[model samples]
Target: MSTLLIKNARNIVTMDGERNVYPGGSLYAEGQRIVAIGYDLPYDKADAVIDAGGKIVYPGMINTHHHLYQNLTRNIPFAQQCGLFDWLLTLYEVWRQLRPEDVYVSAAVGIGELLKSGCTTTSDHFYCFPNGVSGELIDEEIRAAQELGIRFYPTRGSMSLGRSGGGLPPDEVCQDERTILTDTRRVIERYHDADRFSMLRIGVAPCSPFSVTTDLLRESAALARSYGVRMHTHLAETEDEERFCIGRFGLRPLDYMEKHGWIGDDVWFAHGIWFDDGEIARLGHHRCGIAHCPTSNMKLSSGTMPLAKMLKAGVRVGLGVDGSASNDDSNMLLETKIAHLVHRLTDGPTAPGAEDFLKIATVGSARVLGWEDAIGSLEPGKAADLFIIDASKLEFAGALFDDAALPVLTGLSQTVDTTIVGGRIVVMDGALVGVDERKLAESAQAAADRLLGEATFRTKIDYRARRNALSM
Candidate 1:
């Protein structure tokens, strides 16, 4: 078994039960699990050691929701100012032309950015599958995550209700219910690992209420439960979604989901911005999880999530960057910073502080994925997942007084120095350890050019011109 040690950190902010902070701390790990964390750990000999002097270490942040494939289409000019529905309408045309290579490159780009920004574990919600495209697209995503060595939870997301069926995506991009469930089962059997400190886990997710039928939701939940995997989907993200649910099912989003057997601890819904008091209470009671995407919400002009109320109601809340197309970036620390600022503006004194949001991003996110027992915090027997930031940097020079809040408050505009996942260093000195970033960016740009070029040719819409018009 390989051993790793991180010693002499300026502060180790372990997001443990007691929220321990060790000054000049050291941590030792055997294989994937942490063996000890505190001052001056004994028996320091190891295959690898990170001397974290002048740096602050914290439990690795977890992103509960994302669409990594959307990295190819970020900041599209026409789609920039649109709300969720119109935004989907605009991007679906481009996304429908996605190839397998596109998925792989985009996942690499997104995962690399997340790693550089101090996220060790992330869950991606990839739902778009064009009609003519063959091969397992989610498999490509898994390969990318493996190459980069980031802990990944990839949901087998499907969209069955097409525009013909009053859904948002075109009919070509949607699949039949049978195919969706069969693939969901196949991925779970093939890729899911429920063992402690697992590198990959699979989830069952039907895109959303408007994009899927009731039958698909119920069956997907059943399939996931059968395999003992978690389920995820987008819900209550916008007023349009709330209206869609009420118009179609005569119930709010939560009630509709609950009626379909989706109300449980194992199920997590993304962008839960539109739920009411009753829905929040029910969510807390049933222990449903919410992946709050503050940047996406603000970018789309979606209302701020009632974060303080949800926390007071005991709901499970975690931070996510959502999709790169919407949020336009995959930096989890930036997401954490935005989560802190937005809630403070809306929830005022009742809003949780920067430290609380850090906990939410770590422990709360692990709970959302039902992996709390293994990967959330830094403690003996838990997964060795954490990141180190140099507090001596100029941005953080005077902010060393509050080590816990440094990442959210002052560590803005900078990536962490080192990011370790499961006793492995995937990012060091603000760069990916395993991947060539320049070549990856070139390939990503090529893929994006092909997709947008083909989409414009087919649809006769000048997507680039529209974006260019913005600058002019």
Candidate 2:
């Protein structure tokens, strides 16, 4: 078996059951499992060794929600100032032009950015499927994640409610229920791995409340449960969504979902910001998980989630970068920083600290994805997924006092020195191990340009002119 060792870290924030911090620590791994973690681990030789002296080591952050395909739609000028509904309306036209190549390149770009920012495991919610394009878009995403060597949980997201049915997306991008479920089963049988230290898993996600019918929601959950896989979707993200649910279903988002048999520990929702106190309590009671996207919420003008209330209610909460279209980038460390600051601003001194958000990013996220037993902490028997940050850097000079909070408080724009997933080094010296970043960026730009051009020509909409008009 191959062996790897990380020696002499300035401090190792283990995020273990006791939240241990080992000063001047070392960790050893045999294959994908951590063999030992403590001060001065024994045995000298290994296939590879990372001298982590002067670096702070932490379990790699887990991103619980993302639309990796949205990387291609980032920074669209017309959608920048719009709130959630208007933003979706503006971007749907562009997203409908997505080709299989767009999905591959965008997933690569987004996952590569997450790795640089120290995220090892990421869950992507890719739901947009244009009618004429290849149905193997999720396959393309899996290919990209595999090439990048990051652990992936890709949900086969679908949308079956169209504008004619009072949903947001156009009919051209929506699929029939049979088609959605058929592909969901195919992906699960082909990709969902329940074993420990699995590199890829599949989940079922039927877009969001406003874009999917109630029948699709119920069927998707049933299919996921039958295969013993997890379920994910966007829910209670905005006031607009709340209104849509209330107007259509005669119930709040949570109540509507609960009626559909979606309230359970095996299900997690992205951007859960619009729930009431009772709804929060019900979610906690059901042990349902929530993926908090602080930056994306702020960018879309979605109100602050009752984070303190949810934690107090014993809800399972985790951090996610959300989609690149709304977040405009995939950087987990940056997301942690924003989560810390936003909570402090909204929740006052009683807010959870930076270290708390770090745990939420690692342990809480692992729990949300139902992989807690395998990959959240730096302990013996857990997967060897972690990252190293050079605490000796100039930006971190005065912040080493709190090693656990160092990344969340001061890692602004700080890429990690090394990122390892499944005992393999996917990033070293703040760069992807085997990928040419320049070429990837150029390809993404060209693909995005092509998509936008085709979309504009088909719709006869001048996005630039719209942006100019709005600004004036």
lDDT top scorer: 2
Query: Candidate 2 regions off by >4 Å?
Result: 465-472
List the global CA lDDT of all models.
Answer: 0.90, 0.91
Cα lDDT tens digits, model 2, 1-472, are: 8899889889889999999988988999999999999875786789999888899889999999999999999888777888888888888999999999999999999999999999999999989999999988999999999999999999999999999988989998999999999988999999888889899999999998888988998898888888899999988999888888889989889889889988999999998898999999999998999999999999999988899999989899999999999999899999999999998999889999989999999999999999999988999999999999998788897766889988988956669999999999999999999999999999999999998898889888765544643321
Clashing pairs in 1: none
Lowest lDDT 10-mer window, candidate 2? 463-472
**Model 1, which residues run further than 4 Å from truth?**
467-472
lDDT of 2 at 48: 93
The digit string of per-residue lDDT tens for model 1 on 1-472 reads 9999889989999999999999998999999999999876785799998888998999999999999999999967767767778778888999999999999999999999999999999999988989989749999999999999999999999999998988878998999999888888888889989888789999999999999988999999888888888889998989988898999999998889999999988889998889999899999998989999999999988888888888888888888999999898999999998899988888788788989999999999998888899977899999999999988788887667899988988866759999999999999899899678999999999999998899989988767755432221
Per-candidate TM-scores read 0.98, 0.98
